[model samples]
Target: MYKLLIRPLLFLFDPEKVHHFTFSFLKITLRVPFISTIVSRLYQVKDKKLERNLFGLTFKNPVGLAAGFDKNAVLYNDLADFGFGFIEIGTVTPKAQAGNPKKRLFRLPKDKGIINRMGFNNKGVEAAIKQLKNNKKKVLIGGNIGKNTQTTPENYTSDYTTCFKALHPYVDYFVLNVSCPNVSSHAKLEDAAYLKELITEVQKINNQQNIQKPILLKIAPDLNTIQLDEIIDLVNQTKIEGVIASNTSVNREGLKTSTEKLDQIGNGGLSGQPIKEKSTQVIRYLAEKSNKSFPIIGVGGIHSAEDALEKLEAGADLVQIYTGFIYEGAGLVKQINKAILKA
Candidate 1:
């Protein structure tokens, strides 16, 4: 029904606008008494056999909504109705800022992908906390945090630290997002020394907190083997919780989308089907290198049951989706869960 009726209508508008409209509609519909229960029964696949315990947290299943989808931490409970075992919110910063200029988000429907230069456009950590605090669902929530774009690389630690501290009580886990290609200076912080320092600072804060939440690093799929090795070694040394293998990639190679059209879209991380292999490769690399010592949350290009299963087979302790959800709709979650159970 979504693909035949709903998606075609939604596709008529700008991708980002349609996204907001869809969420707003769902939020409104979900408010009606018993609607949430109906939606949950339709979408939420409950299979105890698919349950997973990762990073000291018990997940109802391994499938999760990747960070970018609910940047401000809105719609978590509503989204959980779609059968995701967890929902990661944000790439949220310390301060609220409008992301990139208009058209920062684009759709490549033919390629089953999305290109977004939405430079951490979010309502900031404070607003996210308020929304999260009201969440009624039990699904695990991972907070994906990043520095404000205006903040310099030198002061990056404070930005991450501020967000980490503020969102500590609300989130079940943390994803340090130093690899958002859409932001200008943000990706520069991915250097090993800077990452080490940033993680160290956040870890210090985590230790001081009453409850220590797991911290995971979200990295770009574009890193070289040496960079991957450094990250592996860093994870071992820092004692951080885990890693979300492969954020959206800056690389646009082999895309079926024409260069002229893509250039028109300009710069942003390319996600969806184009990223699956690269993301899985990173997951495999990290898993192989770490010998599964560190948990890996596989993300990027997961649109089907096979994709989700492949990631699990490749070494992901769990998996996440963004473009996959856009292309395949809510049913994707239940499909993945069913696949996990079958596997």
Candidate 2:
């Protein structure tokens, strides 16, 4: 029904506008009594076998809604009815800022993909805390944090640490979102030495707290074996909790989207079906190189149950979906869980 009727209608509007409209629609519709209950019954798949214990937390299922979908943490409870085991909120920063200019988001319907350069346009960590204070504890939540857009190079660490400290009490886990292509100073965030420093500092703050939250590094799929080797070493050296296998790809190779249209859309991180293989390959390489020493939350381009299984087979402890959720609708989450149980 969603793919045939709802999605087509939603697709007629601007992609970003549709996102906001959908969020508003869900927020309004889910609040009606019995609606959430019915939605839950239809979409949620619950089984002991579906539960995933990773990084000292148990996810109801291995499937999660990736960050940028619920950027402000507003729709988590409403979205939870759709059967995701967890929801990652925000590529949030210390301060609120409008992301890139207009048309920073684009859809590749033919390719089942999306391209976005939305440079962390969030309502900052404070607003997120207020929304989180309303947490019904309906689903596990991960905080994906990043540096502010105009933040100077010297204060980059400060921006992240500030958000980490502020959001620590609210989120179940932390994702140092370093690989987003929309953000500034992309190279510095990926630098092995700098990552070690950042993780160590965040770990320091975590230890100071009564209960430390798990910290995971989010990386890009575009990294080669050598860069991935650095990632393995970084994880080993820093002793951070885990890693989210990928963020989004800057690569435009083999896209079905026309070159002329892509040129008009301009540069941004590409995601969805186009990067599925690339993400799986990255997960396999990291898991292989690390000797399966740390947990991995695989994400990027998962559009079906087979895609989720491929990542799990390649050594992902869990999986996340963003573009897939947009393209396939809420049913996809339940589909992946059933497939997991069947497999």
How many angstroms is residue 214 displaced in model 1 relative to the true structure, after the best TM-score fit? 0.3
Q: Give lDDT tens digits, candidate 1, residues 1-343.
A: 8889988888889998898988899889998999989988998888788889887899998899999889998899888888888999998899999988888889998899999998899998899998998978668899999888788767888999999999999899999988888776755678898789889999999999888999999999999999999999999999999999889888989989999999899988899999999999999999998899999999999989999988999999999998988888889989888877777
Number of the top lDDT candidate: 2
Instruction: Kindly state the number of residue pairs that clash in model 1.
Output: 0
- The per-residue C-alpha lDDT of model 1 at residue 197 equals 88
Error at 111, model 2, angstroms: 0.5
Query: Candidate 2 lDDT, tens digit per residue, 1-343?
Result: 9899999998999999999988898899999999999999999998998988988899999999999999998999899999999999998899899999998999999999999999899999999999999999999999999999999988999999999999999999999999998888999999998899899999999999999999999999999999999999989888898999888998999988899999999999999999999999999999998999999989988999999999999999999999999999889999999999999
RMSD of each: 1.0, 0.7
Off by over 4 Å in 1: none
TM-scores of the candidates are: 0.98, 0.99
- List runs of model 2 lying over 4 Å from the truth: none
